[model samples]
Target: MSYKTILVHLDTSVRAHPRLETALQLAKRFDAYLIGLYAVFEPNARAFNVMAGSAGYYEVQAAMRRERAGALERLFHAELTRAGVSGEWLAPGEPADRAVPHHARCADLVVAGQDDPGDPESYIGESFREHLIMSAGRPVLLMPYTGFFATVGQVPMIAWDGGREAARAVHDALPLLKAAGRASIVTVDTKADDAGPRIASADIAACIARHGVEVEMVSSVSDAQASAGDMLLSRASDLGADLVVMGGYGHTRLRELVLGGATRTFLESMTVPVLMSH
Candidate 1:
């Protein structure tokens, strides 16, 4: 029911500090063990040397990665000390797309950054977030690439559709929901077929209320042009929600991951932190 082990992904990008700050806040709040995992893409020395035809190219890259890792390790420890939290630092030299998910499986929650197209240093490949969500088997709290979130889980908005994924996400976020004291559950463009006949937002609201979280239900009818994801973001903005809880819907097709429309929208343009479980 509570997060005892929280793993955070750190890298050389400018957003790493903010991501770590969010993680630290959660660790302190939940009295959880914090893990600062330094995982990033390091070029394959042998392959890159063959392509570049320069023997020293790989060495230069390796040295730079090491330097950045050292700096980040120091920052992680200092922040943990300032926060008075117990944690450990890990730098497993491997591609982050693979390493992060591997380490995240052991934690109750995973804190990571949304992929930044503007920052090539932070790019681990296409569909990195999708891969993590689908493979982590745990809730992942993703921070936007461009924002400073001083607090999270204070005012949360839940995107509900009554599907299995949504149900999983709601329960996975129970800890934060209870801590927030209140939350808004928004259902956009709902159809009987989508959420079944008997289940309603009010029903889910009551369930959450039983857990001591005051809940409000908002049913919105999206315009023909506006997608469900757009409506969810708009509602989050109107409610001043600091965190959003929703399911990450995606499926593998032809060995490539294709995210659902709503999930894709949030990943690309989230105004607040999102806690997603698949």
Candidate 2:
């Protein structure tokens, strides 16, 4: 039930170090294999060359990309050695949105940083986080860009919706739940059919109890003016939760990975580490 392999996305952005350090700490905690993945996109000048053909421009651009890749590779190895953690590095000549998800398929969990909306060059695009969570077929642990997380899974909040995606997230988070000291399972905006949610919450609590986790069930009715995500976050803050476990996008159609309301809210205003699956 433990994560045996962890894959982390790396880039040349300002927040990359925090993301990598967080991954390193998790790897050490779980004693798992850590893999650092970087994607470098080489600019294509074919469209420009359609009117003005120049092979030299493409060559120079390719050289610059290669140089940047080398620098990033060196940094990765240096950090890996200094940390003394078991890991490997992969730098593929593809877009991050593609390469990261490709490698993420085989990992037990993927670690990524929250996209900084203010930094246009923030290694990964803001939307790519949702894309990876939806496409990777694995659980993703996202670190907040504005905060530092030295450890995780001590106190967790589970956002329960009773959908397939939410169920998947709960199951995927079993390893962390099994090790957590305390946890809370909360449902937001439940239907008038309270019996079903009560039964479901009790069942989930029982399941986690078997894993040796102290679990509590919480039910909150959302205000008409506030979104479900906002309520969940507020509750999590009240509980002083360090980790959030929830589904990625259960209510809305992905349509090329466009996020739903709750999912988008988590991406935009996450204060703690989030573990999401779809």
Candidate 3:
């Protein structure tokens, strides 16, 4: 398997350039068609109109949004031309929470940046990363908010949970893993009451072996002080892993996403590129 089409979600965020650069490198490596998507989220104006607002204010707000979108489009085109890669720009009027996933479904992979929790105006909503990973039905390559990643999928570390989500992530990452020089599968065993049935990590390693990846299995027990996600990152750092493969886990509550503990922790302090699937 190979990536033939790559979709990158870009916006007014400062991190968009680095994320685009990474996507361009990946596209060039795979000779894939790159699609740049810029989505502008419109606030709910109906609520504002009830208080002291008029239709005139709404029109002004929309005009400002259009101007921002136009600026983003110009930036996108300039970068695409400089890169000299086969690509297209898409600026959709819909909110990013819905529009990104819709456009990502047709791409082999989606590239995006990790949201800055403190930035209220983050191009991608603070929670949109997890939401898109769950809804896109494709693999998402997420770049941390503060870092420069010139290469990825070279040496990967897989966080294995032996669950459906983990399995799906491993499957989705087959193309990258197969191309990597080496990979390590890290599994952490916790002492929780409902930890589910035990599974051998070697079995998963054997399956990956068929794909010609130089793979190894590492296992550890998680303690109260350090969670599974912490252990995984520690191992990744020790092994100098450039890419991490894992599952994105979350549940919707009252239309909001409540992520699993490990999933949340990983995103909050991620130090390397992560390929996640739900």
In terms of lDDT, the best-performing candidate is 1
Model 3, 1-278: lDDT tens per residue?
88999999887667777888899888888888899998755677886678675767877977876787788777777876777778899877677988999999999999998887665446555578888998999999999887777799888988887777788888889988987856899886645477577456788888889888888877663767888788788888898899999989888999878987778878888999999999
Give the TM-score of each candidate. 0.94, 0.86, 0.88
Report lDDT (Cα) of residue 162, candidate 1.
73
User: What lDDT score belongs to each candidate, Candidate 1 first?
Assistant: 0.88, 0.80, 0.83
How should the candidates be ordered by TM-score, best one leading?
1, 3, 2
Q: For this target, which candidate reaches the highest TM-score against the unseen true structure?
A: 1
lDDT per residue for candidate 1 within 91-197, as digits (tens), equals 87677788989999999999999989898778775688899999999999999998788899999999987777787889999999999899999875544455454
After superposing candidate 2 on the true structure, give the runs of residues whose Cα lies further than 4 Å from its correct spot. 40-43, 47-68, 123-126, 190-199, 250-258
Ranking by lDDT: 1, 3, 2
lDDT score for residue 21 of model 3: 88
Indicate the TM-score of model 1: 0.94
Question: lDDT of candidate 3?
Answer: 0.83
